[model samples]
Target: MDLLGGAALALGTVVVVVVGGGIVALVVVARRVRSGAIPRFGGTGIHELTRRAGTLLVRLDDRLRDADSELGYAIAQFGADAAKPWADALSGARAKVAEAYRLRHALDDAEPDSDRRQREWTLQIIALCEQAERQLDEQDDAFTRLRGREVSAEGTLRELRSRIEDARARAAASRELLSDAAARFAPAALAAVADHPAQADRLLDDAAVRADAAAAGIAPSGVSSVSGILAEAEQIVHRAGDLLESVERTVRDLEAASAALATRRRELAEDATQARAEVESAPDPDSGAAILDALRELEAITPLSPADPVRELDRLDEAASRLDLALAGSRNQKQRFAHALAAYEGTLVSARSQIAVVRDLVAGGRAGVSARTRLAEAERQLAIAEAETDPVEKLDAVRRAVTHARDADALARYDLGG
Candidate 1:
């Protein structure tokens, strides 16, 4: 054969083998599909899942129905309003269970073209089943809680009654205590209770009414009302006790303050007398005039009856302190004046000696006219210092004399070239 015929033959052989293999594969696939040996894409598995989910949903529905019946019975035994939430939960669960059943049926009947859609339906059914199961569990939990409340209802009522009775006893005791206190103390002292006695009595009465209402099985609100009323009663009793204590404390404080005022008044009188003596005995009575006037004013003060005596006492204390300060200042001023006088005398003597020295320098012609003028000025200052009566002015004159005299003596020596 030629090269082209050989190549054509090889190509035809390859084509035949490929076609034959394809036909065999098709046949095997067809057989498997017909015989149910091969699993359909998302078909068998999804169907099994749907069946299982449907079974679980049916079982859950049955349980929910039973639970609903029980809840209904409980409502009947108790009140319809009491178990309303539980009934609503059970109804919701039943509705979801029904939806789960419908989705499961759709999953089972879906066509091959709708395999993905059927899987989605299967998933939805599972979710609905789980949601329904959760709802059923909620119902169960609610029912359990309701039963527990029912079991404890009698005990709660008994406890409420006991609390109300205790509150009543306490209120009675408080009222008795208030009455006794009112009798023991003056009416004015118990003015707080007197002002609001009606309100306090009303609190107790309201508590009694609430307690009666609770005992009559009105509602839980009745119990809450009782608690509020009892709280008000307690507050009233506490206020009354506080008022009594305040009145008693006020009385005691007034007594103590009155006694202190009397003692302070006596002390103030004695302080005024002593301040007068100090003013008279002061070294410089003229300087103590302000203090004596203050003492007189303190002695003249008289507090009106029922007026605050502390103000009067404050005035007296201020006056006494002023007298003490004034006395001390007067003594200090006297001592200062004496010392100034001594210093001024010493300065005058020194000035005179310097003037004499300057005069001798001028007489010897060693000092010039300037020294004579300074010496004359020094003598004039020294005369002024001696003639001055005010100690402070005298000291000023003496200081001036000393300065002028020293200057004159220096000029005289400088003229002598010594």
Candidate 2:
């Protein structure tokens, strides 16, 4: 009996030891998990952080826009002196949001970052956006209080009425400009601003209705009661005014492009003459062929007929550039550099024009990720080229910009159904 009791005691001691060891292991594992040494199943990792950052970025951008509208309303009603602090806060917030966007764009680029680095960038974006939100919230609270103070409703109504009259006149001018553009250019070229006149009219109508509402509400409660309505009316009028102005600007750009087309044609003729001289002196096959091609392209352009000036300019610049490159071996170093410097200007212009077109499509959500990435790169290269002092390097940078711009354009058009 003594031997059996001793055996049972030993087995029970072993069981206790084993159970304690298991519990100890579990405790260490839990600690590791809590400390992030071992990731939890649904952890806040890079992917999660990226998604949250994107969402927060968009929300912060929208808030900033609204804050801008509020600032404008505050200034118009209470004057710039009263709105200075809010404006300062808004400026700071905009800076923060812009930095966040820059970081996000970097992460979205082709180069891949390690998981740890990605997490750091995403966290920074979230932090910047949150800071902006907090700053805007504080200003918004102060703005609300400011709105509650007494303001002159009668004067505000008078200002709004005058603005509405101005907007109406601008809208009329925009309609006429659109008619002129329609007669001169293809319908597709004016698609961006085609509805501006009608949209401005609609906004004006809404502003009128809100202005009338504010006028009615002003006499009953006070300026505080109608303050929001007045702000809405003012903002709508501003939007209408902006739309009308954009139409005028677009038309002006088209007219400037027409003038530029004529100027560029004359320049191309001069460049072709220079290229012919170079080819005749050196007798290079490629140079001679390039000059002929460039001259043919120049002859193909008709200034009198309806034309896409930007496209024509691009074609002429590209042809001239090819001729310059072909004759590069024939020209002296000084002449080559001079020609490169001039060619860089035309290429830079073409790059900027293409980038602007792609950026607009991206803003309209008609572009995909590929297009956006290329556009970002193109802008970066163009900036570098603009700051470059070395003629050869600047030319190289501008050519890269043109390449990326064309790629973005092609991708964007493809995404828009080819």
lDDT per residue, candidate 1, 156-248, as tens digits?
Answer: 546555654554555455556656655544443333334233444455455456545544543453312123233344454454444333334
TM-score of each: 0.35, 0.58
lDDT of 1 at 257: 38
The alpha-carbon root-mean-square deviation between model 1 and the true structure, to one decimal in Å, is: 38.1
Question: Highest lDDT: which candidate?
Answer: 2
Off by over 4 Å in 2: 1-145, 148-150, 283-304, 344-362, 365-368, 395-418
lDDT of 2 at 219: 55
lDDT of 2 by residue, 1-418 (tens): 3322443454456445545564454345345545765433366767777788899998988887677567778776556666777777776777667667766776788999776556656666777788888998898888777666435676788899889988998899889889988899766556657887898999999999998887776654354456667888899998788777767766666666667667667776777777667667766676677666766666675654466665666777667666666766677888777766876766666677677667766765778999999999999999999999888789889888888988998898889885
| Cα RMSD for candidates in order | 38.1, 19.4
TM-score of 2: 0.58
